[model samples]
Target: MGKVTGFMEFERLKEASEAPESRVKHYKEFVVTLTDSEAKIQGARCMDCGIPFCNNGCPVNNIIPDFNDLVYRQDWQNALETLHSTNNFPEFTGRICPAPCEAACTLGINEDPVGIKSIEHAIIDKGWANGWVVPKPAAQKTGKKVAVVGSGPAGLAAAQQLARVGHDVTVFEKNDRIGGLLRYGIPDFKMEKTHIDRRVEQMQAEGVTFKAGVFVGEKLVEGGITNLAKESISPKELMAQFDAVVLTGGSEVPRDLPVPGRQLKGVHFAMDFLPLQNRVNAGDKLKDQILATKKNVLVIGGGDTGSDCVGTSNRHGAKQVVQIELMPQPPEHENKPLVWPYWPMKMRTSSSHEEGVERDWAVTTKEFIDDGKGNVRAAKCAKVEWVKDEATGQMKMQEVAGSEFEIPADLVLFAMGFTNPAKSILDAFGVEKDNRGNAKATTDGEGCYRTNVDKVFAAGDMRRGQSLVVWAIREGRQAAREVDQYLMGATVLPR
Candidate 1:
């Protein structure tokens, strides 16, 4: 809208990245931001699409065109404001979100989509640099108390919103730090913890309390998942103390491969391996840090978690890294006519994959070969073909005859994604669960976000299953509104 022919004039320019060889040496953000002029040019590329599919495509429904117009007009302050209007943590989403908004961009039907995420990153970074991001404490206290369990995006978003609405909000985290997966699951190389720290400081100023190292239910049983809780509060105690409780805990139960030799020492869940590096990055001394140094690493699963393992392994100076996917490889380019205005299925090579990794698709692990001493030595795998069944019209995976193979793997990390939230917390609250094991909570109608138990709400990954951070924020904001309405008889908070 800023420039009528800007989309035709400017080609999409992605943010520069540090060379894999150099960036792998340290765990720090390597994606460089666009200069002011570059960002402005990118902003100008946004077309005045009537539908604004990017808005709907974004999980948090970001006002993309408004921010783009603001940036193009050199209104950085307004751009930041527009960005913050929808996303509570643009810095987090700007860095890690897959940018489905771009995929749904009108321009992307034939041409490259506008660099929306980069513009967002620039606006938010500029906002912080210019001290535009500050606390907006509530005007008056509401005389109500709310408890938010889990300090990830959802819990943090809900806590901030509830606190800003004049309610006393306390966010409880099982880990020693505030950020849940953001602080532990994600590698520091993608996003530094300082972003979370500053937000925590701002939230604190906004009348939200953060109680780190406080588990709200039973102790976590997962071996690698971090839990620094010195004290545990039962659901009964939390219900007795707070007016309402919001369960925003993440989906922490990782899906496991129960193949032969899964009990091997070096065959670990990705959660167990990832958090250790995060702890080490935080300067925590650990006697047993899982290392990939000089080890042949095999990362199973082809999602973001697997890509993270690839990056971390490279940083650990792994001898070799191989990433496997159960599904067949997607097309390198999407058919625009067939998948316009929606997320397209295509090959996505992450920065980690580019760094160095042997990737195999449509492959399944048959067994983790164990050394006599009990450590994983290799992985026996087989290539499979996906065939459509005529009866059910479902795709079935069939192993190719004589396609069995083995790869040297001293350290095998299973990054196949999470199945559900830790059942202990959900059971502690007596919250109903969907068939998928996520906390059962509706997203619309009168009882939205309200669990079967009175005065209890569920949001984010805990309610919707594992999803994008932007979705988590959206759920959190919506849940906050529902909680506020339930508390005060009505609410004015934006959904």
Candidate 2:
């Protein structure tokens, strides 16, 4: 550690964001960068623990202590290198990932954890500003060709790793843009697309090719333009063309609620609503966006996805916004002794919650009520009680009688998480899926990331179901090593 007793001397300080009222008016990032001195002080807070749990706490297993020490010593170049050693894209994770590393920080047992995310953000941003982020092309080509399906974080990570290892890597994205959720699902106010753009440029400079707007597999019959564009390619060709094919496609199939009036108008998936706004922000004109402007928006689910919906709605000038969750409200504070060094259950007030939102926990939507015109207007909901099971020692939820009520809503967005990757893409590649509908791939096992089909592998949300961006990066890097080893005799890449 740069400062051995720094943990005892300094307190945690992080980058601050603009006030909710002010930031909600614009779609640009609002976080204020920390001064050099402030960042050094924050880095000094990293204790020289014999065993750094923050590394284990991080999904990508970032070298936290090393970077903290580097920053404390004012070695900016070394700090940036340390940040990039594990994570392929720190900016994305820094902005969006729920910092489990901080949750597991050694200091978090008594006080607030080290501002690891902010430090990560600072390191990478400084690297970019200093022109330290440059492409490192392989000296020799491995003569291996890899087709990484999906250009999200997982695919991006895998593509970059393979490219660095001298494999000819190409990332295929179905969307018009490269980033999957990062470009579409996420609001620009949190992270602009320029961050992704510069990285794409660096990856390109490093010899990784990106193919966007090319939907692989069987084409949809309903859409116009029946003729296959040479521009468009088939899964059959991809199978024969590449030495290895890694499926990093995200979990696209959403978890739908099949309550009565499920087909009612003005009810849509959160993904459907969020992407359109992103398109608008990206200068692409969307004709009939699922606008929440002056609409009574009702968002269902209480996860990050739901929080994102709340933030988006508030920016859209929603008439009223209400969120519902099936689970009971968590305590304001977690019992540190029980959940230290692990993600604890507690109430989390997000930036969106602070913007404006009426939230209810332990509430279940029974049915969507509609106006005579066929547009959704209200929903019948019931509050539930949570109980614990004796045999399994598991928690269960049960609805209470006489608790049903109605709330008016002009628009209802299902912000529930995804169940699995779309079956079509998986079936196209003939990959085996687990009970959860995620691709069957073990972290440590023979044929890791290897699908039933030869030369096909899977990782990230496609393999792990819905998960954090950090986990996706970890899976992507691991899958890259597995694919590299499978292609050649062995791999020199890190796990």
What residue pairs are clashing in model 1?
Answer: none
Off by over 4 Å in 2: 220-231, 390-393
lDDT to native, each model: 0.93, 0.88
Q: TM-score for each prediction?
A: 0.99, 0.97
lDDT of 1: 0.93
In terms of TM-score, the best-performing candidate is 1
Q: Write candidate 1's Cα lDDT for 235-342 as tens digits.
A: 889999999999999998899999999999999899989989998999999998899999999999999999999999999999999999999999999999999888
* Candidate 2 RMSD to the real structure: 2.1
